[model samples]
Target: MSSGRMRYAPTSKLFIYSMSTLYVVSPPLEIFEGLKPELRQRIVTLPDFLRYPAGRIKGITRSLLAGRVALPRRILYYWFPKAYFDCLVQARPGDAILIYEACNVRVLRAIRPYLPERVPCYIYYCNPVGTTFRRPAEELQAIRALGYRLTSFDPCEAERYGMACTGQYFRYPEHQPDNIDSDCFFCGLPKDRAGTLQRLRTRLEAEGLTCDFVIPRTPAEKLTYPQYLDRLARTRCVIDISQKGQTGLTRRPLEALFYGKKLLTDNPEIARYDFYRPQNVFILGKDPEEQLRAFIESPLAEVPETVRAAYDVNEWIRHYLP
Candidate 1:
């Protein structure tokens, strides 16, 4: 495996690298779909699932290759084999290759001696998998030595890894599923039905901020994206507390920004993200009572549109993605 960097402008050069094959082992098609045209022309997708049964797997694969099924251009080697390793070794220099999994990175490292020294390797990160920032010394040191640039779906996660001393972290645009109805105020299961939520609600109510509460549990109850967006429009403030305690600003906070809804979250750690501590989003301490009351009593409609736009996805793309 060669360690080097290659840059290609979309216009003058498309696929300047010798090998055109690109192997993606993850779900997001958005990242590579934007690749230069010539590179896209010679791409193969390896399905992550290949071991179940030849009849079932091969039949589906044939159907896909036959154009009966729709899949992104990529290839997945079902079982690891020496032939795969051999092909990697024989791969021409300047072959633009990418592997997105830790296991695959480990495999490539195991055979590093056999690979050319200049192959550009990029590692995609989704999450830390195990370490929380509070306890991340060992994992931090190991990732730094891999000598690969890191790209992640979540900007906050990338930032967290950076804090832990991992590779340089970059944010790749996320593939937010269309299934999420952006118009709804509350996504996820209701706190009432999930006893823990009911308890939290009880505590909030006891504090006397008696606002209307909506809970959407199952798929059927989930509002359409437009509806969710509309609900956020109707609300003065939205909540973005996480089940995992105080951590990164989850998708909910980002969604809150998209809808331009003011937020009151229990997660103080959200302050780590850019545009967090400004007038648009507020932090609620462990005892959310006083702050919650003050916010409820304050005139929220007076908050300016500029403040609301701080969470705008467009702004996010400009600041983080670009």
Candidate 2:
């Protein structure tokens, strides 16, 4: 409810225009705190399912028809949520447009025409492209040809797709940190990082630093946002080791920034950011265990309010616009 993306109109043409009201269509996430209240209210969650389990069949059917039978938008549009309709209907040329998450593209395609004329759209990649987007090059090429602006936080992706390199965004809750019980903490779906996390945990423990690592095996094992934040509250630092070769700064560093905690990340790109502080961050592979231990014990360098403000979702929206 707090932060998902809004439904969108298609990216069919370019309009030399700017709007104070930005409509974002993204997969559900909880990190929308950076925007003002009015902007925050515009977010809409994607892949909205029916109230009952049986409705999923309808979604699957819709996807199938759109793919196989070439169902026309006039008929397929009914499958979307009313929120999607309202977003398109109420959107004016004065509003900014953004789309995220690969799954939501179908919805954008389904109701492309209802949107304002010649309003350019922005698609931001929040995760690594391969992990989140499975569509072929042709699909993306088609999207780009239609005048949508593609962007990502990953420099590699930006180079690969010719997308505008953009900054990542986050906002922490007002909840204060709990008394620190561990030296470091990490929680995420264990996609190939399980062994690496366990190894890091052991190494940290060997160095006399307690590590709280949560690598969920099943969907049920995944922690809700509140639960994860509670764990984060207890740690002096947060650990972020990306899948090998992932160089982009993920949310871990931002979490560390907002929570006033240190971070152990493997991202070499961290050094390139304005907030990078040797005292506050320990890069994996670059830092020996002894160095990491010292980093955990080091006094966290304070990030200025201005530096922190630059990473907000609001700033992310404003940065990529023409």
Candidate 3:
């Protein structure tokens, strides 16, 4: 008997050179799955050869060797460094290239000689200036010269560094609970600071707010993403105080706002963001004893519907993806 199904189908199609191949380099695997699972099915992960002592050439060589693995028609290499640009340049004309970080302008420039003349390079950046721009001034200048279009969380940071931003950085929306689980003060203590948290705990106890608080104790100690969300949900309020560095709203305030809890942060610029309000976030200085007392006694209710409506994640995703 004839195999009718196999006989009827053809595996190959006519050659079409005009097809599209979108490449995303060094992107988070979670986000990849979220964006388009079908697309990720066609992804080719770049190896971590850049971690080698000899830099790009060695890394590129390693990646080429590892490339015995099949490559997708629409290829994506996650977290490859600038050194990999040469390999990207050698890719098919219809192939797309994505750059995840703007920090490596120097590497981008180095590959200027090889960048496909018509390919578009996309940058998705999420760095506060103090961290990414801390290298020598000359290196910083080199990054600026490359002039990659950027996506960042804060416009002010991009302006401060003399870089133009294409759009705002997108993040997943905060999902807060309707009821408060515990009456407690939750603060993240600096691991490097010896006895600092102990002294602060002692002072809070003297003021009658007596709790050791949930703080990570070891370098290996880390909460899973869901556990972190749970932590935000359980606590009535979050104390956001950055003891060092340029204080912007770190992740804490965002988490607090989403959980519909009060936030006590030292950063004044937080007021400018859509999340902060007198009822929700309270700005405090070095000593928050009085303010902390008032809050612990009577916490604010759930965030208003109007405010919640404004912080939608869908809008953020549309803005970034579009």
TM-score of each: 0.47, 0.82, 0.62
Model 2, TM vs. native: 0.82
**Which has the greatest TM-score?**
2
Question: Which RMSD values do the candidates have, in order?
Answer: 10.6, 6.0, 8.8
Model 1 over residues 1-322: C-alpha lDDT tens digits? 1223343433222222244444333323433453444434444333332222266765565434422233232333332333333344455644434444443323333344554556544454444434333344445445446555555544456575563212212122233333322211344555423564566566556766444456775678776655554555565567765654225455566555544456767677666655464455666554445565565445433434565444443232221110
Question: What clash pairs does model 3 have?
Answer: 26-78, 26-79
Candidate 3, residues 79-153: lDDT per residue as tens digits?
234334334565455555555554544345544445566655555555455556566245456654554445555
Residue pairs clashing, model 2? 5-26, 5-44, 6-24, 6-44
State residue 192's C-alpha deviation in candidate 3, in Å. 7.5
**Which segments of candidate 3 are over 4 A away from where they belong?**
1-106, 110-125, 165-200, 207-218, 286-288, 301-312
Alpha-carbon runs more than 4 Å astray in model 2: 1-20, 27-29, 38-60, 67-74, 103-108, 320-322
Q: Write the per-residue lDDT of candidate 2 for residues 34-114, one digit (tens) a residue.
A: 457654554433333322124677767766654344455456545655545455446665565677743344544545555
